[model samples]
Target: MSTNATTAQSPFDPDKSRIGRVLCFAAHPDDIDFGAAGTVAAWTAAGVEVSYCIMTDGDAGGFDPEQRDEIVRLRSEEQRRAAALVGVTDIHYLHERDGYLEPTHEVIRQVVRLIRQLRPDVVLAMHPERNWNRIQKSHPDHLAVGEAVTRAVYPALENPFAYPELAAAGLEAYKLPWLWLFAGPEERENHFVDVTAQVDRKLAAIHIHVSQHPDVEAMERTVRGLMGQTAERAGLPAGRSAEAFHVVTVNGPGTIAGF
Candidate 1:
């Protein structure tokens, strides 16, 4: 497989892999846009189908208490608009409470069902482990989502008997081959996508989350700076941008029956 010039040997490359579909899981509406919208845009531009599975509506978000009752609807709408900007329209909302997500059995089963139904070639999710250097990225909801999706991608989704009701409903067991964990600690990052060309697209998508950002311009600058730093670390050319990830080969050559 094509590997980055700066990264170590790997089995798959985002540019060369026959990745047809990608399913992304996030704790809130804006999470995906913040973490991986540039990569999503690149994939869609390459003719891959991308979908978002938001675990929460971000009901507890927004700066004003007066908007609490309307936050859910507002955030959901914003996410749809943001996704559309990056060529994604398929979205699944689990409606799990914001600020209180957990890797419960029901949540795992829900994720498993989606995996079976969509049968995506790759799944991108938040990092389950906390990043001590960047504590904000390790939101409780994000960690829960990562763990839940990780569980679903393993024996649960591939085992016919794990969630029998899903099979009864015609969603058969699926073997997801690859997973990408975002917002992880620096040392664990094994993949970096040079997103310089798609940075504008990513910024446009992030701008859609107006309710979540009090200063859009400042947020854009910060995101750009972060991406630039990531690119530098990945040995990309100066002025380039990138999004990093910890890739796991779920059902690939190295793994043994999804172990």
Candidate 2:
């Protein structure tokens, strides 16, 4: 839908919020684009700093083992290119084994350390509270990464006592109260962004993941079609492209003050 039509009362203002640093944690390489690249694009266009923390190297994402390492390398490059398209400069690959992630203490500690180092104003991640029945448990890694990131956002990053090494490394305690979790089955989303203005940029970013470009393109078309349907359903302007998000307040006092 056109951004003007979707404009409603909400606290999220891409123009006002100075997103000094943004940390986006995704299950795989391309998950960020699928979930919230449009918003990321908008944020970066407004000069907000953006960074990506990919949970896996995607070594097992493809069908061939003979060229798996090469494939992973190329995928990482693609992710970097995609980040650039969205005006993001830094991309961190955790180098964890793909498709084999587990919510171990080691993993939690690593995520907590990254959060502490980045000191981001906003964090985006896969929805841990997604409807379990509908979720594809086939990818246990996705679930594991999501759960770990969720846990690390709070006490792990905010609690000074949780990880002593972080403080030792000169990383002070910081809290990211604003979090956006996508793909949840029952999230309370009161905001919608008219990405019509930024749809091409979003598509260009998605196209960077060459391994998933075909699938990503198909999904983008589907999303556009769905936006059209949503417009028609609402008796608003049809054929308008858009993106949706579920804003979750994770820490202290939340407010829709500027909406």
* Model 2 lDDT per residue over 50-151, tens place: 889998888777555566659878888888888888888798878888888887888889898888888888888776655564475225776677688888
The CA lDDT of each predicted structure is 0.89, 0.71
Error of 1 at 63 (Å): 0.2
RMSD for each of the candidates: 1.8, 4.5
Query: What is the per-residue lDDT of model 1 for residues 1-259, given as tens digits with 9 covering 90 to 100?
Result: 2223245344566456678899999999999999999889988887889999999989989998889889999999999999999999999999999999999999999999988889999999999989998898999999999999998888899989998999999999888889999998888888888888898999999999999898878998999999999999998999999998888888876667635
Give candidate 2 regions above 4 Å deviation: 1-18, 63-66, 131-139, 213-220, 226-236, 252-259
Residue pairs whose backbone atoms clash in candidate 2? 10-259
Q: State model 2's lDDT.
A: 0.71
Residue 46, candidate 2: C-alpha displacement in angstroms: 0.3
Q: How far does residue 22 in candidate 2 sit from its true spot (Å)?
A: 1.1
For model 2, give the 10-residue run with minimal summed lDDT. 1-10
Would you give me the overall lDDT of model 1?
Answer: 0.89
Clashing pairs in 1: none
Winning model by lDDT: 1
